[model samples]
Target chain A: QKEVEQDPGPLSVPEGAIVSLNCTYSNSAFQYFMWYRQYSRKGPELLMYTYSSGNKEDGRFTAQVDKSSKYISLFIRDSQPSDSATYLCAMTQRRAGTASKLTFGTGTRLQVTL
Target chain B: NAGVTQTPKFRVLKTGQSMTLLCAQDMNHEYMYWYRQDPGMGLRLIHYSVGEGTTAKGEVPDGYNVSRLKKQNFLLGLESAAPSQTSVYFCASSYLAGGPFGRGTGELFFGEGSRLTVL
Candidate 1:
């Protein structure tokens, strides 16, 4: 099994709808969880980051991590067409000083239609 | 200010041909990384550097080599290109900073990307 698993969803939603993307991992040592957004022909950009397990809110985006279940999620409120992109879930083993390499999931493609 | 920039946005090469992808970051970050993104495979690390003059192999280092002689640049080289080496290459950098209540943390800033196709 892959270290991280995410559904490669071409999920389409109407404007203003709430969208949820999820990922599951088997590694218990992954402490740093992150969500990245990649537009067509562009590099992945960091959207949300969380340490260990907890919930973090930023604008219309909320990221939740459940360490016990090895699950992580990103929720988008009042989605818009501008939010359409590939959402990638990534995580790394916690270490001191510098950050370690990230293991990523097969990103879920989101299309928020107007 | 260009956060991160990659050279040769697109390239195509035949088998046995060699090429180098260059990455430059002006953020003066201490950590830089090279990754390749492929469909269904997500992003795989090729190599990384913690600081100037230091380099280390990543998860997918085979058929590739890297050098970080300068602080602002990291290069990924394919000595003898293979069809399997074709992918979108990305460069990212991060610096240790105080995050969320004085905690030492960091986040990656990525370049646009370099698409290379090896035939």
Candidate 2:
């Protein structure tokens, strides 16, 4: 089984709609959770970061992590056309003084229509 | 700021031909990583470096080699390319992991990406 699993969604939603993207992981050791946004022909950029089991809010985006369930989610409110992109969930166990090995999900594609 | 820059934005290679992808960072980060993205496969780490003169294999390291000769540069080389190796390559850098909360949350800065086609 893949370490992280996400729905490969081409989910189309209208502007001003709320969009929720999620991922599930089997590794209990994963301590850091992240959401990344990738545009066409571009590398993924870090969108949100949270290490705790609650919610973290940044602007219009909210990231939720449920450690017990091994699930993480990113919620976008009042979505805009500019939010159209692939969203990927990534996680890694925190290790001091070393490189953290990150495992990424297949990503969920989202489109916001006008 | 040019956080991370990858060279040869696009290229096509004949099977068995070899080439190297270069990643340079101006952030002076202590960590660097190389990942490849494919349709429905997401991004898989190829190799990574914790500091200059140090290199380590990642989840997908076969048919690839890496070098971190300089603190600001990382190189991923395909000794002999294959069709399966054709993918968009990304290079990223971050501060050392496990810092105090809210700082350097392992947030990675990435380059645009290098698209390689093996025909």
Candidate 3:
């Protein structure tokens, strides 16, 4: 099984709707959780980052991590049409001072319509 | 300054052809990585560098080689490309500062990505 699993969603929602995206991981050693937003034909950009567990709020996005459950989530409040994009969840375990290898989910594609 | 820049935004090559994708970062980051994104497969790491003159293989390093002779530059070379190697390639850098240096403590600045197709 893949280390990380996310719903490959083409979930369509109206503007101003609340959108919740989630991913479940199997690796207990994965301590860093991240959410990335990728636009069409563009590189994935970091949207939210959480180390270990707990919730972090930034603007309209909220990222939550549960180490015990090996689950992570990104919540978008008052979603807009411009928010349409693919959201990816990534996890990693550190390796000294080097960059840890990141394991990513297939990504969840969301479409917010006006 | 451009956070991260990748050369040859797009390219096409026949099977068995060779090419090198260049990545340059101006952020003075110590960590750099190369990844390829394919449909449903997500992003797979090709190689990574922690500092100048140091490199390590990643999840998908076979059929590929990398060089980090310069701190600001990381190159991914395909000795002989195959149909399976066609994908969008991205280079990313991270600045790890403060904190306890946890598992995921830094933000990765990524390039625009290079799309290559093996015909």
The best-first sequence of candidates by lDDT reads: 2, 1, 3
Task: Say which prediction, candidate 1 or candidate 2, comes out ahead on DockQ.
Answer: 2
Q: Write the per-residue lDDT of candidate 3 for residues A1-114, one digit (tens) a residue.
A: 999999998999999999999999999998788999999988889898888899999999999999998889999999999999999999888654657578899999999999
In candidate 2 chain B, what residue range of length 10 has the lowest lDDT sum? B97-106
Tell me the tens digit of each residue's lDDT in model 1 across B1-119: 99999999999999999999999999888889999999899998989999899999999999999999999999999999999998999999887545443444467889999999999
Residue A56's lDDT within candidate 3 is 97
Candidate 2: Cα lDDT at B99 = 49
Candidate 1 TM-score, C-alpha based: 0.96
- lDDT per residue (tens digit) for residues B58-83 in model 3: 99999999999999999999999999
- For each model in turn, which proportion of the native inter-chain contacts is also found? 0.60, 0.77, 0.55
| Candidate 2 segments whose C-alpha is farther than 4 A from its true place | B98-104
Candidate 2 clash pair list: none
Residue A76 lDDT (model 1): 100
Runs of candidate 1 with Cα error greater than 4 angstroms are B97-103
Alpha carbon deviation, residue A64, candidate 2 (Å): 0.8
Candidate 1 contains a number of clashing pairs equal to 0
Worst ten in a row by lDDT for model 3 chain A: A93-102
